[model samples]
Target: MVFMNYSTSTWILILGPLAVFLVITVWVIELLAKAPPWYPAIPIVIGFAVVFLALGVLIRAKLGKIVF
Candidate 1:
């Protein structure tokens, strides 16, 4: 078995972008509910989530080494 070591800040760096993505997704849902748009929101949101998740992973991999 293998275990990963993580500190508070390290976890934050890894999850921050994902957290932001979740919050923004909620806001987008509200906006969509208030006024539906012609373009499909699903693809856009999916892409946004991908970007955020990638960024979080990148930050964790890079900054995690430097900071912690």
Candidate 2:
């Protein structure tokens, strides 16, 4: 049986989510500060959310399984 590294797994999860959250928050804030209520930034926000989610999935996959 292979022993997994819990510390590495934790860091991977934390860093990926943190980075994605920060980026999305910044983007939305910027758009809101500039665009009007009827602007098209809504779709762009959705697209970014999807991309960030996919990135999280990829990060988890790369981290593999953690047994501890």
lDDT of candidate 1 at residue 18, scale 0 to 100: 75
Q: How well does candidate 2 score on lDDT at residue 39?
A: 61
lDDT of 1 by residue, 1-68 (tens): 11167767766766776788788877776676666562367667768777877887786677666766
Candidate 2: residue 53 Cα off by (Å)? 1.8
Q: Write the per-residue lDDT of candidate 2 for residues 1-68, one digit (tens) a residue.
A: 23353577666665677677868767776777586873667667767777877786676656645422
Q: What are the runs in model 1 whose C-alpha is more than 4 Å off?
A: 1-3
Would you list the C-alpha lDDT of every candidate in the order shown?
A: 0.70, 0.66
Candidate 1's C-alpha lDDT? 0.70
lDDT score for residue 62 of model 2: 64
lDDT of 2: 0.66
lDDT of 2 at 7: 76
TM-score of 1: 0.58
